[model samples]
Target: MRPAPVVLVSGTETVLADRAIRLLRDTLRAEDPTLEVSDLEAGSYAPGELLTLASPSLFAEPRMIRVDGVEKTSDAFLEEALAYLRSPADDTYLVLRHAGGVRGKKLLDAIRGGLGGGVEIVCAELKRDADKLDFVSAEFAAARRRITGGAQRALVAAFSDDLAELAAACQQLLADTDAEITEATVEKYYGGRVETTAFAVADTAIAGRHGEALGLLRHALASGADPVPMVAAFASKVRTMAKVAGARGGGNQIAAQLGLAPWQVDRARRDLQGWTDEGIGRVIEALADTDAQIKGAGRDPVYALERLVGIVASRGEDQHSPQRTG
Candidate 1:
């Protein structure tokens, strides 16, 4: 027989992939240390190496081939692997891992196509809010920890939608606390600790509280808010200010652009009503500058962000205007 079709796993749900990989690796390692394990990356591999007998790696030991990648390897590799999976060898086990989405769906489809049977195994991703709850409950049960229903909801609410972070929180709670895992503990550990979202970032910037905005920015950066998303939020606020500055009415356009649908943009415009047209123009320019900074143009992003926030809060661009709004 040949080797098993590489067990193709993929998702943005990396925690799931990681947990599965850990279990498979440990189980195989415990079963046989001398198991010739080969880890192949999708991008780094060619289809020829996946073929048996003709290629090189023919050893006497029970060889397990594991492939991990950010994307599907290729059609050639998949086709070759499927042929191999038709009659997999007893001495070998093949496992493939991917961070799935639209990104690496080819491998998934291949596994589901022809070889999905007694000899083959396919584990698709668990999605939806309900599925996530079930996962959390099952994970705790597997770990022999008990969690209450309210506590579970609290955990999800407080940690946002990040499964990895939620798992970490659960593991930490399990390790640190001995209680039955109550809602109070979830509130204690993960409350007021929610991540900063794009909307919150916009709110901070528009409030013109430079110090708070800078602190929130730093906190967000530390909390895994990527620079691209954050700058996208900044761009949103800049576009709002630009439109509001150009108009005497239609604050709705400004609010819509800022993701503040149904919110009173006029109220916010009133706050910046003292800001001259030139001041708003400079603010827009500053946003562009900071966008470049966050994207790696400037050396110190934090300092650049702080500088930009300070200028916006202080309305420093007013000095450059030939006439003030008053």
Candidate 2:
């Protein structure tokens, strides 16, 4: 789709905002290879700068003037930009990038009020796992590339802390291979990261492989993995298992009810195998205690982590299996 005369790329998600800007530039360039691109810093914008860049060139080539740091625009910029909105120049696309602040509320309000006839491309942060998964899916879908649900979840779990890294990983996969992406593919590329290592430990422990779980856990710690998120990895999986325990319905329906993705429901169902509600609850308690210990309750975080691994590896049988009270 062609960009509007005025485009507002607004949000705190830098990666998404950058992508939006790049896509606009590419689309404009495709339409007219003579596209004249220019960058402006709103924070240091001088008087008459916007008009100068937006004015018709001698050859009358199309222009895309990208103004960044609108969230911290100078007073001069604020006045000029709002005035320019009243009568935007022809044959020019004014792209505004605001990273979110009250600094330019007047300009943003004007744009949103239809002053410039601009369309906003919001780049809101993907704060939830479901949102991030959708981002990965969209990235592949845009390129007609196929990625397995498990692979998507793996990529999300591996880079949940950073959306930029996750997007980069998806791009690498897309560029490096034409074959459908799978979990093994993601693991091959990003398995060495501490986040993946933490999940690996959690997966091994949850699968009841006590010895292997310990090995992975120790290896992760030695690799300088933080105990907090490692414990968090266990907490995340066990909690999903707990949510899926005794829940009935298809993956999609159950996932909708639990605010999880369908693949998460399926994975949680598989993880719940050979596990009882009592076992899940027990492991959750272990996770809490371990979390506390690692966060300054206990002197030896390693011992606490080891204890947690054993508890999870045994499906909570490491402790006295608490009987359910009617």
Candidate 3:
């Protein structure tokens, strides 16, 4: 298929958006070795700069112009871009990256709807376990390899907090091993790392396993996991549960409304089995105190997190007792 003259990459997922841009550059370079690639930040460029870069060269060589942060672009740049789009140079490929905002909707709509052979590539953020699983599977498939479901879950659990790290892990595994990726493979490569991420701590705490949660929290801190993200994870989980509990629709509908994957909604529903509104409120209050303590409102962040784990695990058990204040 012929490449589009103008490409609009829209999304907040930095990793995916970056991958798309790289793939486009690679494709153009392969087709023409003399392709000239230029990178620009829309928020910092001078007026008429885009037109000058996209203008056909004296030798008429193939060129690819990549402009990032277009959502914060200047009006002058937008006007110049829109004018150039009307009569795009045949040897030029323009790539615009926007991180999902309404700041430049006029230019965005013009590019998306104009007759310049434009293509819109979505790089929506992946917030659900299922979406991350599909990403892992796709990575393996791209390399003509296979990964077991257990292995996929393990990888996601290990690096759930960072998509870029997860992608790097997939690539590293592919490079380091020739066998099909499996749960055993993940354990062999990232066992200690898995125990230290916030998700692991949050998982056990939300399951009401106080002992396991405390142990995991200790291991996580000892292994260099920051206290801030750990508490943030707790906040994230509780917020998701609250959203799911208060939602009025089915899994898919609620997932869409919450920008979550359907499985996440279902998982949150299951996790809310014994949780009461009063219990959730108490846990949220405890988390707030821990958040403050870790950020200097109190002393001993570690103690704060431990107390938080105890409070969260004990949620829905005794509503009358006062929550521990760090």
Top candidate (lDDT) = 2
lDDT values, one for every candidate? 0.60, 0.84, 0.82
Give a tens-digit lDDT track for model 3, residues 1-326. 23688999998777787789889998999999999998776766688777788777989999899887688787877878888778898889899888778978887899778657788999888999999999999999999998999999999888875677689899999999999899989989887673337877887888888888888888889978889989988898899999998987544467789998654675677679888999899888888888999999987788788888888888744322234563
Q: For model 1, what is the error of residue 97's alpha carbon versus the real structure, in angstroms, after optimal superposition?
A: 2.8
Indicate the residue-level lDDT of 237 in model 1.
60
Give candidate 2 regions above 4 Å deviation.
195-219, 222-326
Model 2 agreement with the true structure over 1-326: per-residue lDDT tens digits: 35988999988777787778899999999999999999787877789998999999999999999987788799999999889998989999999988787989998998999998888999888899999999999999999999999999999988785576678789999999889999989878876677667877888888888888888888888878889889888888888888888676544457779998644665676578899888888888888888899999988888888888888889988752222334
Candidate 3 clashes between residue pairs 3 or more apart in a chain or in different chains: none
- lDDT, candidate 3, residue 310? 82
Cα lDDT tens digits, model 1, 204-292, are 65666666766777787787666666667666666665665555423233455655532234334544655667767777788788789
Which stretches of model 3 miss by more than 4 angstroms? 192-326
The deviation in Å at residue 172 for candidate 2 is 1.6
RMSD, every candidate, angstroms: 14.8, 15.0, 11.6
Kindly report which residue stretches of model 1 are placed more than 4 angstroms away from their true locations once superposed: 1-6, 10-12, 52-59, 98-110, 113-127, 194-326
Worst 10 residues of 1 by lDDT: 317-326
The lDDT-based order of candidates, best leading, equals 2, 3, 1
